[model samples]
Target: MDNKTVLQFQSLSSLVDPTFWYSLTKEKIDNIKLSDVPLDIYGYYSYNSLQSSKSNDNIKVPSFLQLNSNSLTNEIIPSFSFPMKGLLKNTNTIEDFQKLDKKGLFEKVSKKIWDSILNGEAIKCPSLLNQFLLISFSDLKKYKYYYWFAFPALLLENPIYLTNTQLLSDYLNKNELQSLHENYQKLLEIPDNIKKGIPGYFLLKKDDNNHVKVGTLSEWEMFKSDDKNKTIVGFADPCVLPNNPGWLIRNLIVLLKKKWNVSKVTILCYREIAGEYADLSQCKLMDIEISGEELSDNLPKSVGWEKNIKGQFGPRLANLGPTMDPNKLIESAV
Candidate 1:
């Protein structure tokens, strides 16, 4: 294992569908006019993502942690998994959006994640690990939406190094893969688990008999054998890249180091084809080692405000003018 193989995580980007803007427009005009209060919203990532999944023609489509009309509602789409509970702050003006305390906001959210990890809340309800912030200024007049998304991550004192990386399919033999799949499906069948949306992050291990048992984060200790090396921790990976895992894995490693106090661990970046749960070859398995995790109660330096297309620190603009223009809607209707 090369010590130079430092593990890196891919950052998050906002993927707002037109339906989301349309719904927000209706919400603002019909209800939340001029109100700057934050609204409860959620976004989700899936195992069956285009980044890792193929289309009917076998081409890989683009993917994202998308927000649409459904994201604004409480309705749960099973396939739209790992729901990231988020806050939506629609500012009254562009100045307000611009002047918002971005660093302050990032710190605040990161603290919550840190607290959850320390107090064991995240171990119980893993969705808190993926909480996000969305600040926006919807220009109703121009039908353009300006927004920035932040997925805050807690930085560990010691960087996690990649010991080795391999395809998950190749890591496990045919029988072992079958057991993992069967147990995972059983985990998803828990109705309460379905409602709460924390099943994406899981702990699993194989017994001497080669039987696999999947458990919630809270059940980690119960499923653990004497050897931490035997246990594998995993998350539903959202990254399409073959090598890099998604952004949330950073804080998860933090949680593992600080909470579990593990120095070496095996990580499974679980990826699957959308609507095709049987395909797991796209998943990546990694062996990583980390040291020097502080037990201090204070939160570490926070990062993960999504960067702009130019890779600069800035907000992104979504000009939905044409599709949202009322005159064009009427004209096209005629």
Candidate 2:
């Protein structure tokens, strides 16, 4: 056959739908090459319920099968036909084939075939016919959830696979694993500086009237005599701060100054040294220290500020009435 005719036959043969088999003709069956005949024949018989039994007379036997009638009867025909007939006897639809418990079904089918082979009732063609039966059954089991996780991974361009760390460690030297751990630690640190436009670090203070203000130095110019009335708090690591400082400061001013009306916002430091702040202002102090490894392990559960205010950032902020006033933002910063 020419290339175009071969391509057309292939296109029709690949279809598994019952509609393809019901419309088959004797001339079309005769024209297909002998090697490609088995697939089409299997497809036709598997979906044979869509066509009446009387229509089988219209389909011609392939020339190769007619020439080797004894071999076809002894092996090839039984290999392709019986297992499909047995499977279809129990299954009504494609979904029935997919929902079958594969392990139990494989054991049951193999045992029956083995018994027939041992009794000399049916000839076994393990390299040919028997292989086809086992493979076709396996395909039916896989078609159900084949693309469940794969489709999302393809779209995201991040396919994840399960790995055995112990197997991988056996192949690598001890020094390589230590180097990998050190590199991981560097990745987790908060950077000292960000891009040029953003500020590095600063301190925030809560005054007697419960107003939050920011300044470059730890000590603010406006100071009161009573130590109990004022609170001093230090903030650093701007690289870890989400959104710009202007946006964050505006949200904090609205939340702390206007909404909560609190005298102070305290940050309990983890994994850091205590300071000598005698010269600085006296304030109510609470200290809780934790190791870096413990902080890393517990960070996800302890931090939830992002979940509460995520919608208030970026373009979504427009939905929240008017933006924070520029004059009030300037007043909050020294």
Candidate 3:
């Protein structure tokens, strides 16, 4: 298949309901802690450069987004000011905001103050008249709150699998696994190097007609589909491992084991750090030692190979080799 075909096929699988996505989005949005907002927002109002110090971790949002208490209140449609002002700035970045940095951000906000944010005790500060620029002017649109705090939950949902016994059993009884099996068979028939296999973990279902359905993109597809514009970060030998990658990998395992009874699953890493971290027993990981020579080899040209780059197959194969950057190799695999 050509590049256009590959990209079009990828877009086909990624389609999802905007409404359903919004529902899932709103649940987490409602839980955002007031303190998880940005310090610059306070700067907009109080003109307090000191507010910048509120971020204990030096976290901030994109330089463009203007955050102000009045605007935040209007966006969230809250009746009061937030109790944990320091915490918002403390856990400033988009990622940090997701977790709300509860303990750290709210170290100063007393329970009473915290409750008030939730209870709407703090009224909108009139001093910040310029709030309209930062917020939706219409009361109806005012509910469009920005909660970086809720992001982690949404991210967590990104890799979510339908592993509940009932959901899995029903989907499988309907032919979900069979479809993947068919796809795998079709993939193997492709004539080429078959360079990689990045198996995405997901719940499957098979129907009486032997049709297969997937809860989400296969493991290979998820990582293979990483946006080309974004820099894909893998753990390098030079630094301590980031907590998020480990958590992400662990979640993948949990999803597979719970949904598909995937025991003794193997995950090969293109980098030494990934392999090293996989060595940890609690993580129940494994490593594929990639060397410089192995990384330079080209992928196979085959029918299934066509989709592999668009999916996880290329990266998986790349992980088996060490020298090449996994993300770069996969992007070029096609």
Q: Write the per-residue lDDT of candidate 3 for residues 1-334, one digit (tens) a residue.
A: 1111100011101111223223322433565423333322221111001112234534311111123334223233111111112223333233543444333332222332223223322112111111111110111122222322200100111222221111122223324444544553343343221111111222223334566433322332333222321111111011112111222133233223333334333231111211212211111113211111111112111111112335542211112122233555676785
Q: Candidate 1 versus the native: TM-score?
A: 0.91
Please give the lDDT score at residue 149 for candidate 3: 21
| Sliding window of 10 residues with minimal summed lDDT for model 2 | 147-156
Where does candidate 1 have its weakest 10-residue lDDT segment? 53-62
Please give the lDDT score at residue 93 for candidate 1.
93
TM-score of each: 0.91, 0.17, 0.18
Candidate 1 deviant stretches above 4 angstroms: 1-4, 51-62, 78-80, 225-229, 275-277, 330-334
lDDT of 2 by residue, 236-294 (tens): 11111111111112112212222223333332110111133111111112211111221
Candidate 1 Cα lDDT to native: 0.79
Model number with the top TM-score? 1
Model 1, 41-86: lDDT tens per residue? 9787775656333345456542467798977785765464667888
Better of 2 and 3 by lDDT: 3
